[model samples]
Every structure is written in structure tokens, then in C-alpha cells.
Target: MTYLANPTRYSDMTYRRCGRSGLQLPALSLGLWHNFGGVDTFENYRAILHTAFDQGVTHLDLANNYGPPPGSAEENFGTILKKDFLPYRDELIISTKAGYTMWPGPYGDWGSKKYLVASLDQSLKRMGLEYVDIFYHHRPDPNTPLEETMAALDLIVRQGKALYVGISNYKAEETAQASAILKQLGTPCVIHQPKYSMFERWVEGGLLDTLEKEGIGCIPFSPLAQGLLTNKYLQGVPEDSRAAKPHGFLKTAMITPEKLEQIQQLNALAQERRQSLAQMALSWILKDPRVTSVLVGASRPAQLLDSLECLKNTNFSAEELEKIETILK
Candidate 1:
């Protein structure tokens, strides 16, 4: 059977402008970081993608080194794109990042004109994309001069390989500098992807203010705190949970007894708000005007649907905010 996207996909989901740019992303964007890798089931990720698009999640975030083998995620996405999403390409916002260790030797990693240019070329080939909606520098390269990196991104845009450019994992000062450089080169930094959630609040320190000042949109990854902020951990770690896995970003030791207690407390508050803990976690982030959208990863379609439910109730009361702060404390 052929896959046809739902005609009513945009009827309910929310879209926010990316900074001052004309691009508006769904409130919840799908990230192909973990589950869509070469190691995961194709049918599962395919269903996840279908469900995401059916609900107006037009933004698909990716990185060159996302897969366990590196580059496999893009290959898989390219296959899916060719099969299911080709006709709707104009409506989608596909993004990919570089700046991490991708291949080998000197030119394989970091932020250099040669590396970024080559990496995006490889990424374009893998994803079957003539140009990505957004291309990003995955992280700040201490050894690479900021001018070289920002110029490379500008060049990529001029070459028509990327419509917009952004930076990820960059601090306030770095972002300000990068934004300035890109602006001088006649391409504004449209967005900034950062590690942000209730548990991870480093962005609030200074990054958020800088992004706002620079008029760059903010899309936070790990908004669920690597699944810790969800209800699954409130009772105890599930046998199938990320904490139970021997390998992965979330370690078992990180889910301490104290952390479990906090999860329980947060879940209780979520219940009062008539939302799942995951919803509250996402809603907490979306409540801010500075956050254009949030990057959410789901292993299954149902999980993606549950995460999107956060859209229904993004408002937070003063008491609720204070209580959450106390619980986090």
C-alpha cells in the first residue's frame, strides 16, 4: 500500500517562527539521533516518521555521525525520503550537522572549511538531498578559528547546498561571535540547537539571552532529559528502559535513588496538570517564547504521539513553576 500523508496534518499542531526568519517549525520536531540508526528496525522508524509527518512534525533533525556506524541514519532517511517523502519535500524542513569526528585523519572532523564542506557533500549524497533546509555546525571547535567556520557555512549557503545555517552546542559568547560573523557574511544564523530540559538548564544561564538578542530561534534537544523526565522512571527503572540498557547515553548509575525521587515528585505535579510527565517536561520548555521548537526522539510511533500531546497545554502557573523549581532543587 502507498503511504499518503494525512490531509489534516496541520489542523492541530502548533508552528513557531524560527527567530526572525520566515521558516516556522512544528512545536515538536523529530530527531533521528538514536532509534533511526542502522542498528534499529526499519519498519519501526518508518512508522515513527509517518506518524510524525501525519501530525505536522515537518522538521527532521539529523547529524552526520548519528548512527552507530556513522552516516547510516542519513542513508536510511534518504531511502525513506525517496520512497515516502519526495513529493512533500517542499513542506519539510530537513537539517543535518557536522563538526564532530566523522571519518578519520586530519580532515575527518572539527570545524574547518574543508571538513564542513566535505562533510555536507557526503551528507547530501547520503540523504539524497540537493540542499538541506538547514545545515549546522555540530559544536564549537576550539582549534578552528570562528571566521573559518562561519565562512564555510556562508559558502555552503551561497553554493545553494543549504538554505539556512545554524550552530549547536555553542555557548553564549561563541554564539554571539558566530552570529556576528555569519551576519557580516550576509547570512544570518537562523537557529541554535542546544542541550536543554528541566534537568539540563545551562541554556538559561546566558545562551537563551544571547539567542534572543541575536534573533536566533532555539530548538532544544534532550528535552525529556534522555527519558528521565518521563513517567516510565517514576515507579522504577523498567527492564526495557534506556537505564536498563548496557550501552547508551543514559547510564544506570545516573538514575540514582535521589533522581528517582525527583522524577516521582515531578510526575505528581504533572498529574495535577492533567498531563504525562513527558508532556509536562516538553511543555515546560515550550512555555518559553524564546524556544521556537523542541527536538524529540521516539523509539516508537506511540511515544511520538504522547510527546506531541504537550502541545495542548503549554501554559504554566506561577505556583506550578515555583513547585517545579523546588522539586528540581
Candidate 2:
């Protein structure tokens, strides 16, 4: 079926301006970090992508080293792009990153002018894209001169290979420095994608203030803390959950009994509010004006839809906020 043929699909998920940029992204963006990889089943990947788009999730996040085989996720996602999402390319915000270990040798990774630029070009080819909506420096490279990395980003934008540029996993001070460099280069940094959730409030250390002061939008990834904030672990680790998956990002040790107790209390609060833990986790992050979007990864279409519903109950009363903070404390 054509992506637009489903009339009910467009009724859900809201779009918000990415900071002050002209681009508007779905409130809940889908990420291909976990599933949609080499080991993941294709049927599951296709269903999640199709269902997400039909439900108005127009933004998809990808990185160079996402899959177990490094580039397999982009290759797999590209297949879906060519099949179902090709026709709606204009309506989508497709982003890919480079800066992590991809390939081998000196030029294989990091933030050198050589590495960042070349990785993006390879990413464009792998995803069969003429240009990506946004290209990100996957992480900060202290070894690489900030000037060199910023120059490469400026060149990519000037060449029309990417419409906008963003940074991920950068601290407040580092982001402020990069934002200053990009601002001077005429390619002002537009967004910052960070890992934020109730359990991961490390960004509050100053990152949000720095981005806001710099006019850079913030999109938080893992708003569910790799599914830790969800109900999946409230009882025990499910057999097929990320915590149980062999060599997954979420390790079994992370689901300690103490952590489970925290999740249980949080889930109780969520239940009282008539929302799921996943939704509450997402809503907690989105409560900040600095957060422009929540980058969520889903293994199933139902999970994607359920997360999107978080926006519907985004408002949290002062008491609720206080209670959450106390629990988190």
C-alpha cells in the first residue's frame, strides 16, 4: 500500500520546529540504533518504519557505525527508503552521523577534516542520498582541531551535501566552543542531539543552557534510557528485551535490583497519572523547552505509536515534577 493511502495514519504525532530552524520534526523521531541492524529481522524493521511514517513520524536518525557490522543499518534503512519512503523524501528529516569508529585505520573514524567529510560522502552513497537533512559529528574528537572539524562541516553545507549540521554527545563547554566556531564560519550550528531521560539528567549540568544561549536546538536521544524507563524492566528483564539481547547497548548489570525498585516507584507514579512509564519518561524530557524533539528507538511499530502518545500528556504539574525529582534524587 502507498504510504499516504492510510488515512488514519496522519492523524497522530505532532511536528515541532527544530529550535528556530525552518525544519519541523515529529515530536517523536525514530532512530535506527538498535533494531533495523544486521542481526535484526527485516520484517520487523519494515513494519516499524512503515507504521511510524503512517503515524506521522517523519524524522529518522541513523549513524555510520549503528549496526553490528558497522554500516548494515544504513544499508538496510536505505532499502526501506528506496521502497516506501522514497516518495515522501521531501516530508522527511533523515539524519546520519560519523565521528565514531566506522571501518579501520587512521582515516576510518574521528573528527578530522578528512574523516568527517569522507565519512559523510560514504554515508550519502550507502543511503543512496544526494544529501542528508542533517549531518552530525557523532562525538567530540579532542585530537582533532575544532577549526578542522568546523571547516569540514561548513564545506559540506556549502556544497549542498547537507542542509544543516548538528553535534551529539558533546558537553556544555565543548558545545559552546563548537557553536562559536560554526557561527564564525557562516554555517551556524543548528542542533544538538544528546542522551537525556529521567535516569540520565547529566545534560542538565549545563548543556541545555549553553545550547539555548547559542540558539542551537536540542534533541534528546534515549529518552527512555535504552528502554530502562519503560515498563519492560519493572517486573524482570524480558527474554527478547534489549537488556537480554546478547551484546546489546543495555547490559544485564544495568537492571540491578535497586534500579528495578526505582523503576517500580516511577511506574507507580505513571500508573497514577494514567500513563505508561515510557510515556512518562518521554514526557519528563520534553517538559523542558530546550528539548525540541525526543529521538526514540523502537523494535516494534506498537512501541513507536505508544511513545508518540507521550506528547498528548506532555504537561506535568509542579507536584508531579517535584515527586519525580525526589524519586530520582
Candidate 3:
């Protein structure tokens, strides 16, 4: 059966400007970093995608190395796109990244012009799209010249392969430098994707301030701290949990007793706010105007809906904020 998107999808969700750019993204965007890979069930993947779109999540984030097999996520997403989202292509903001160990050779990795251009070409082919809404250098290449990387992004836009360009996992100073170079090339850096959550507040130091000054949008990944901020682990790590999976990013050591104690306190506060711990964590990130969107990955449609509920009560009283800070401290 062909899936039909809900007509009133745009009614409830909020959209914010991407920094100073004219483009706007939904407050919540779907990320295909997990569960949409080739290893996962296609039926579940399709359901999650449909649910997210029906609820007005217009952006779908991807990367070259997202899947267990590196590029399998893009391939899986491509299959779904051709099947379901082809008609709604104009309504979506699809983005992907490169800059990790995608292949064995030196040209296959890093921030070289050769690598970025080739990676995006392969990405476009896999996704069955002529162009992506945004293409990102997955991380800063310490060895590559900033000019080389930024110039590659500029070339991509000029070649009509990507509408915009961005950087991920870059610090405040690197972002500033990259933004300047892209501006000089007449292709501004429109957004920055970083790891941010109550458990990971590194961006709060100076990166957010830098982005504000540079007029770049911020979209935080891991806003729920890889499910640590959720109630799923309060009792104990499940056998099927990411932490329990030996090869997954979330390790058992990360869920320390101290972390669980903090999560318990935070969960209590979330209950007072009438929101789940996951919802509150997302809402907390959006409390800042600097955040253009929160990138969330969901294994199921219900999980996506639960995260969406954060938008219902984004308000945080000074006391609540202080209490959260106290708990975090």
C-alpha cells in the first residue's frame, strides 16, 4: 500500500530560521544515524519516516558512515525515499555529511577537496537525488588546510550539487575560521551540528556564542545523550539496549552509578513538568534561541511522538532552570 502523508502536517510544529539564512527548519528534525540502516527492518524504518513527516519533521539528516556497514544507512534511506517520499521531495530538507573513515584510502577520508566531492557524489547516488539540501564536512580535518575544506564546500554549491554547506564536530574557533572562508567564497556556512545534551554541555562554553556572532544556525545531535536522558535505563540497561550492544557507540561504562543518580533526579523534575525525561531534555535544548533545531533519532514512531511532546511545554521557570542546573552540577 502506498503511504499518504497527513495534509495538516504543518499545523502544529514550529519552524525557525537557519541562523541568518532565509531557510527555515522544524524545531525537531529526524536523524538517520541509527535504526534506519540496512541491518534494521525496512518496515520499521518506513513507519518512523512516515510518522516524522506526518508530524511536520521536514528535515532528515544522514551521513556517509552512519550505518554499521558505513554507507548502508544512506542506501536504506534511498530505498524509502524512492518508495514513499518522492512526491514530497520539495517539502523536505535532506542533508548528509562526510569526513570520517568512509573508505580505506587517504582520498576516501578527511577534508580534502577530492574526498568531499567524491563522498557527496557517492551520497547523492545512494540517495537517488541530484542534490542535497545541505552537505557537511562531518568533522574538522586537523591536517587539511581550512581553505581546502571550505573551498570544497564552495565548489559543491557552485557545481549545483548542494544548496548549502555546513560543518560538524568543530570547536568555536574552527567554526569561526570555516565560516569566514565560506563567506569569502560567497557560500556561507549556514548550520553547525554538534553533540549537545545535559550530559554533554561542551557547546555551551563558547561554540554557541561563536555561532551567534557568525550568524550560523545550531542543530544539536545527542540531545538525549544517546538515550541516557530517557527512562529506559533508570531501572537498568536492558539486554537490547544500545549500551548492552558491544559494537554500539553507547558503552556500559558510560552509564555509571553517578550518571544514573543524576538521571533519576532529572527524571523527577521531568515528571513535575508533566513531560518525560527525553521530552524535557529536548525542550531544555530548545530553551535557547540559538538552537535552530534538535536532531532526534527514533527506533519507533511512538518514540518520535514522545519527543515531539516537548514542544507542548518548552517553558522553563527560573526555579526549574536553577533546579536543573543544581542537579546537573
Model 3 residue pairs with clashes: none
Candidates in order, TM-scores: namely 0.98, 0.96, 0.99
Q: Which ranges in model 1 have alpha carbons more than 4 Å from their true place?
A: none
- What is each predicted model's overall lDDT from 0 to 1? 0.95, 0.87, 0.95
- At residue 188, candidate 3 shows an lDDT of 100
Which digits, one per residue and each the tens of the lDDT, describe model 1 over residues 1-329? 57899999999999999999998999999999999888999999999999999999999999999987799999999999999999999999999999899998999999999999999999999999999999999999999999999999999999999999999999999999999999999999999999999999999999999999999999999999999998778888899999899877898889989999999999999999999999999999999999999999999999999999999999999999999999999
Model 3 TM: 0.99
Tens-place lDDT digits, model 2, residues 218-258: 99988888888988888889998888978777999888888
Sorting all predicted structures by TM-score, with the top scorer first, yields 3, 1, 2
Task: Give the CA lDDT, 0 to 100, for residue 259 in model 1.
Answer: 94
| Candidate 2 global Cα RMSD | 1.5
